[model samples]
Target: MTERQQQRSPSSGAGAAPAPPPGDADAESGPTVLGFAPDTAEDDETVEPVADGTAARVAVGSDRLAYVRRPDLVGGLLLLLAGVADAASVWLPWDRDGDVSGLSLVVRAVDAAPEGIAELGRTGLWQPAAVAAGGVVLLVLGLLLLRPARGHRVSGVLALGVALAVAAAVVGRLVDVGWDARSFGPGAWCAVAVAGLGALGALKAVLTAPRVTTVPAERLLVG
Candidate 1:
């Protein structure tokens, strides 16, 4: 070849190839770099976050029981009101007559002798005393119903006790001549019936009540 042709001969050696691009040091073993193997990188496993104090495990059953029944609470409150009314009758001082204000109504009802039964209205401290004792018992029982504890059996027993006490009071009232003219005075009958129904309600609440369980914290979260 001529000397000028040889000088511009593509500056090529006999058969040497171009050099390859530099390889990533962490590409194969570590997470892939951006734009490379993205699909495979996403599939890589990772640990989930956990609560600080509790373990990762949870119980689904207990979560359902946390909700309380409104009807049960209503029944319990009704019983409590009945107890208060019964207690008020002991100190209402109705035996004196003309004490019919809202506050004194409860007292008058207990000692009210009416016309015929004035002699029977003599409380001798025993009758009014017995009623007050029963009232205290009923109040305690009603409060127990409000608690989260299992009170089905306890409530039923308390209700029964209230019913019995009211019945005895009514019987005592019937023998005396008072505002109530009949052998069984109006007040006596009402007290008996109210206490009996209250007892039944408490017993029913206990018998039909469903079991409640605590819910786990994990179940509280939305999916």
Candidate 2:
């Protein structure tokens, strides 16, 4: 061969590099950014995941948990009724004052001179006010009991205190005003009944534990 041809021979420095081995693709590809595996053009198949319906079940279970259950519902409804009855008691005639209803008591108290907490108490409408306040609180508590995740223990305890206060207020009023009770109106009886019912509801709420969320194992796993 001539000198120029000899220079281009296979053993010469200018000879093209030997072809790389076929199985060493890993060596040919460098590490990707963010430590991700490098994507290869050969990976064109789309993987269709199996539809297990687990996610749907999990969602349903969570949604159900948002509402109060049957036992709580009944109790809550009773409490609501109790609150309404007691509140109405404040409007109806509790005792006979020349055939006047207790509803007039507030107006009369506002106009009367200070009379301390003895006969009618310093605040003439203390008992009625208590009944009204307690009833309102009970009503709100009852409604709260109908919802989920309200910390039932705390709400129940609060309701219990309110119920007891109302009961005491009603009893004290009866004792104070009973001597003059020529004719007790339906309001008086209604107040007592509602207070009793409210107390029961409060006690029930205090004693009961909240329901735990239940979901299928598969749903939990999916979630």
Candidate 3:
């Protein structure tokens, strides 16, 4: 053989050897060498997820919380009534000189009325003035009560003041009649009754107004 042929021959140990052994794919093609082996793609296909209505509802509920809406309807009406009662008492024809003779039927009767807190007695501008001031105070307190986050102490003080005023007015009338036992017997009782009823009404208003803090939204929004 020629020298070139000899150099190229497989027998020549120095020549490049056969290409490397066939890889995994070629080996699989040659024989059924299957044993237990994980089929990752098949495993992935088996894990199918589905939409769950109950689970979705639970998730949505978990994200949200309950809240109590402030009471606009009741508070609004109360505020309006208070305003009208205050305004009419101040503007209406309520003079003292009308008749001191009918003190029992007119003065004592009207004074004892629940709305008598705003009534301006014949005692002139001073009594009316005091009544007007009390009315203004009551209006402010009502406004404060309407607010969701007002202090309880504030409401309590307001209620106590109103109650005391009403009580004092009634008690004073009793004293006026009792001291003059011969003249104003029943008229004193009339004064006491009027003052007592007014005290009760004012007490009710201040005590029952919404004062509880029920939710996070209330604290966050009502500052």
Candidate 4:
């Protein structure tokens, strides 16, 4: 055979190494045999690893619903009545003499001279009339705060204060003058009744006031 033919022939063995099998050759060097085997590496995108001695904390918020208490109708009504009684006491007679009303007592006390101040005090009418005026203002404020159930604690405390004032004024007058029915008129008795009713209503309102609270909601995590 010619020299070129000898070189191309498969049978030629001299000066040439033996060829390896296809399977062994591929396992060693062919294209790395790309394939999808079960991946042994940790996926940072899907899995999170916490420290050995630390806990993983997720941030949460108070995005939930809240509940409120109902209005106190009975307490509101009592406060309203007390306010009305206080206003009426201004026009009603404060002494056995029908000519002397609460308004006239206040006017006389305001217009009295330094020497006449003692005369006004001796009658013991001006003190209760002045207290009645204060009661009217306080009771009106309490009613406004309590009617719609807004500021229950404030209104209740205010009502209690008015009751104490009215009681003190009436008792002081009775102590100074006399504790007979002839000493006081219907207006004075009406003020006494308001003190008792207002105190009861204030207690009820404070006891029945509402409390508010919040709850946390769960968060959804997507991997």
Candidate 5:
């Protein structure tokens, strides 16, 4: 065979297939064992990473109780004292005439009437009992506020409402019998002062209570 012809022979590799383009190399090659591709769903829903130290600071479950403040402590004590004093006032002299006590009023009404319990409202003597009950409710709410909890604001509000209601009842009694100091017995004066002070303490507690929030653990740590 001629030299040129020999060089051009197909068996002699005169012409070989052109190399595959870089983009098509994979297709030409057999199936490749690719490295792991992370889940796209997780990638799409990615959260910003938090620091390890910050993650450790997050509180959980009941451990997330709100921080108590100085005002809460002080106000709670005041309300407790006011509650005790107000409740005790029910046994003291309520009127100038006959020195009728709250308990005495109930007893006399029961002794004189067939429906003594029902007569309480009609004679307006139920005010003292109602005030006493209100004082008790204030005491409970005050006790709750004394502890660190998420319900501080709610307790404070309840306390304030009860205190205000008691104060209003005391004022109503004073108005009914004329506001003269001589018209008030020790019990009446005590009720008035205790109600006023209880209301003020409740107001302070409500205003100073911290707002409680529920957030993700990560967010709590970040904050």
Candidate 6:
């Protein structure tokens, strides 16, 4: 309260709070780039963010199909699964006794082929080798399609043909079973399923192929 002591009072510092250390503001906000220009406050103007991008510019009257690009993995995977099913059918049961799988059927036919023509009935010449081969072919085509490549249409067409051929084999063999019998087993149904899946996958592979191209583009900075 005395005049001399008033000069030393805490309020004598102009009644303002102590200034913080020079590094404290930068530390609290973020690191300051001392060597570069000082940063200005951020502008509040509206902006739409977009990256520098290039889009395919199609030629005049060009085929749109040629410019389109799509991944064939889905269709190819389906076809591959169909082929796997067909091959797996060889291990599944085909008859009431569960004794004759697709592979066994091929073996039996091969064994019977050696019998003389006169003993044809006794030998029972029946074969499904084409089905097995078709499955393998489809599997290969499917793999080709799944990878990045052109000519998917060709692979699809071939796959469709193979599927139809195997389908015929499946149906033809089913003609002999009577209603009273145990009828077609899992192997037979698997054959049918593969045929259907192969057809769909092939169609998709051809129709869903992607076409792509690159064109000049630029990025327009807003701020």
Model 4, CA-based lDDT: 0.65
**Per-model TM-score versus the true fold:** 0.45, 0.57, 0.35, 0.57, 0.57, 0.57
List model 5 lDDT by residue over 33-125, tens digit each: 464434433321333446563323332333344433433677788788877777667788877665787667546645546667567656666
Quick one: RMSD of model 6? 17.9
Residue 44 of model 3 has an lDDT of 15
With candidate 5 superimposed using the best TM-score fit, by how many Å does residue 139's alpha carbon deviate from the native? 1.2
* Clashes within 3 Å, all models in order: 11, 4, 2, 0, 0, 4
Q: Rate residue 86 of model 3 by lDDT.
A: 44
Global fold similarity of model 2 (TM-score): 0.57
Worst 10 residues of 2 by lDDT: 55-64
**lDDT, candidate 4, 175-194, per-residue tens:** 87566767777776667666
**lDDT, ranked from best to worst:** 6, 2, 5, 4, 1, 3
Q: For each candidate, what is the lDDT? A: 0.53, 0.67, 0.42, 0.65, 0.67, 0.70
- The per-residue C-alpha lDDT of model 3 at residue 187 equals 28
Point out the worst 10-residue segment of candidate 4 by lDDT.
Answer: 40-49
Q: Which candidate wins on lDDT?
A: 6
Higher-ranked by lDDT: 3 or 6: 6
The alpha-carbon lDDT assigned to residue 93 of candidate 6 equals 76
Model 6 regions lying over 4 Å from their true place = 1-71, 112-127, 178-182, 209-214, 217-223
lDDT (tens digit, per residue) of candidate 1 on 1-223: 8988778746366675755445654455565557566452122222334666533432233233474443456556766776766655543442334333323433444455453344434542334444555666766777766666544566766677776776576556545545363533333334554566566656665675555667654432211
